[model samples]
Target: MIEVENLTKKYGDARGINDVTFTVEKGEVLGFLGPNGAGKTTTMRILTCFMPATSGKAKIAGFDVFEDSLEVRKRIGYLPESVPLYTDMQVPVYLEFVAGLKGVDRRDVKRRVSHVMDDCALNAVSKKYIGELSKGYRQRVGLAQALINDPEVLILDEPTIGLDPRQIIEIRSLIKSLGGRRTVILSTHILPEVSMICQRVVIINEGRLVAVDTPQNLTAQLQRSQQILIRVGGPEKEVLSEVGKINGVSRVSVKENGADNINAYLIELKKDMVDAGKDIPPVIVRKNWSLHEMRPVGMSLEDIFIKLVTEEKIN
Candidate 1:
């Protein structure tokens, strides 16, 4: 479990982060999202005890990050954006070195190194020097080092950055598998990463927390009007006219025309209108039009992220 309250970090005249606060429940995977220069890394650094905040409080597994840095570090595994690695060391050797640094017992060091290497899919390159490995493998090595200690919390900063599509998927899957067993804080600007891997999102902009919620809840909160997409088999003008007359219908426009006289219409309902699902189908039946399909349109995480960030900037 983690808790942060009014965390602020300043760099002279500029603020790294100001009054940012959120929490990650035990075994919860939280996404730390923000655009470039939005203090995402700054926040992570403070939480990891890599740097100190200008003001406020942060705790990891009940230990204050500032006052109990060592205890906090003991319970956390961190993979920073730029992983610090010994390029000349072999993969297994590198991890073994990290295990010692994390204070793993001498007798357990070998086992821990082997276990993490296997977990990270680095056994094939166990003997290969880190510098000789590809970027993807190098990242795996970084992750292995982070896990060598088997910390209760995992703090990952841009874990998938600069990887090819295939590598990214591989890394994403690995991270996803770690959820529910370890409380994870995944920091990245990638929308798909959050949507696919994180259970909740904390959006930061210009060093301030803008939104914190599950993606579905955030989408619902941001939607002012409801949108419904309906496919009707009938004359376009007649179907549109009939649907537009519904009580809450505000606007209707053709979305697509199918081959057999079926057309898809996008209907926008008035704000706070919650009865489109109940109201639309009966209206279509009354008009004698075949209602092929009807579904509510939900905003994508990208849309929500952009909207939240834009609104934060405007305010």
Candidate 2:
């Protein structure tokens, strides 16, 4: 549904997007991740045909974004990072205007507007002026207009930004519902949003493509060490020495509670050495150490994102 090849966009001496290349398959929800000023908006603009790339090529729904931009525009639904709306117009009114602007069939305007209003949960505020609506409702109105033409590919830039929790949940669910049939490219800085709604994530840092994979795969790739948090009631020095002596335990460090009666530690193991986990737990138990808690450290999307972004900065 989307294809980009060696895409480059530069403004004077500054880089907007640099040598970026990736694709999004039909029926896939691709989450675009990057820090602020990371060229995400620049890339989205190029994909939506709002602006042409300085070099390289992009196609949406089989239509070239530059050469065949008209067809691409007809096939793509774009909700920009900062949604543009006619604040004085009512929900249905604005949608009706956009439908005509997008050249939807004259007779189908009413039907299309109604369908999008219903789909985006804007029916209750259908007659309300956009300026009178809350940010969440205003966002819905923006989303409703994007769907008025029923474009095949949806390019959403921070669709859930500034929404309340309930509204965020509603929008997230709405994006999930649209994924398979819509070929969604969701852009945002929120990691959980990517993890929850995207089937796959494309992480970009400093205008460069850093990684692209399923959420599970990205997290797994960043988890190089099998880390565990352990708390034991014993002399802190003795505990550290014993943990260091454990076979396959490559590194051990006390993370907390050094002055207190109990010591807490974070253990890093040699690659693929977690199978020796059994030996450590057993040794602690048999050595008269009182175990309070032992839990596997969880990897979050934020952790993976930070690690990737930091690595990019270093290189």
Candidate 3:
């Protein structure tokens, strides 16, 4: 329900985002990822109508962002990295204020405020001032305000920046629950959050769109070969020779396992033979080598993020 086309922003020559473009379909949760200073926030601000782009166009719920700023803002709920909050107000009061500002009917304000407070697990501290709450509670308060109006689009920037592990999981679950009902654009440097919560990812680096695809697709796109780690008890040279002869085997290298007589090997299979892991053990058994371990090595999101960002710099 969100579309950006060549969205560019600048502060008098210092670039914010250049030719940034992507889309988030209805009920789709899109993870917006980038390193620091990569323009993630700038892009989000423009989409949320918090700021105007120097050039280009953005639309939310089929309304042009520039032409229908009020409509766009009404349809989107934004929780910025530093949530703008009234520290002196109690949680319930603060949320009620936000609900009113978001155009929630005066008669429905109490029900809306209470529902969001419950959804964010802030009911117990409803009467407590925001400043008196812990960082995690404060973050929840920020999220509650964003949900007060139940907008069709939610734009969150660093929603779980400083929370502890437990708190992070709570917030992550909350975000996940909102999927399929709200179009969400989550902007964060946390890779695992994207992997666990986002349906697809849009990666930017140095203020340019680097890649946009499903996490699995991006990993597969960058992978040139399949890798398998195997541990066997046998003479190193003999084991290597036997495995190297297997069809689709591209290369074999021995790795130190720190155990006597037990050698580890990293086998690289040709790109077309991704399932080569299934063909390895039989070769070892025929040679009388005792296989200890056999597992595939998959590229994680962290690895993919670093690889893509570094490649962008080199090119």
- For 15-90, candidate 3 gives per-residue lDDT tens digits of 8999988888999999999999999999988998888999999999999988999998999899999887888998
Better of 1 and 3 by TM-score: 3
Identify the runs in model 3 with alpha carbons over 4 angstroms from their true place: 258-260
TM-score computed on alpha carbons, candidate 2:
0.94
lDDT value for candidate 1? 0.90
- Native-to-model Cα distance after best TM-score fit, residue 73 in candidate 2, in Å: 0.8
Cα deviation of 89, candidate 3, in Å? 1.6
lDDT of 1 at 172: 93
In candidate 2, which residue pairs clash?
Answer: none
| lDDT digits (tens) for residues 254-315 of candidate 2 | 88885456888898877788766667888788789888888878689999899999988888
Pick the winner on lDDT between candidates 1 and 2.
1
Q: Candidate 2: list runs displaced more than 4 Å.
A: 258-260
Candidate 2 whole-model C-alpha lDDT, 0 to 1: 0.89
* TM-score winner, 2 or 3: 3
| Candidate 1: tens digits of C-alpha lDDT, residues 46-162 | 999999988999999999999999999988999989887888888888787789889999999999988988888998997788889888888888888888898899999999998
> Cα RMSD (Å) between model 3 and the true structure?
1.2
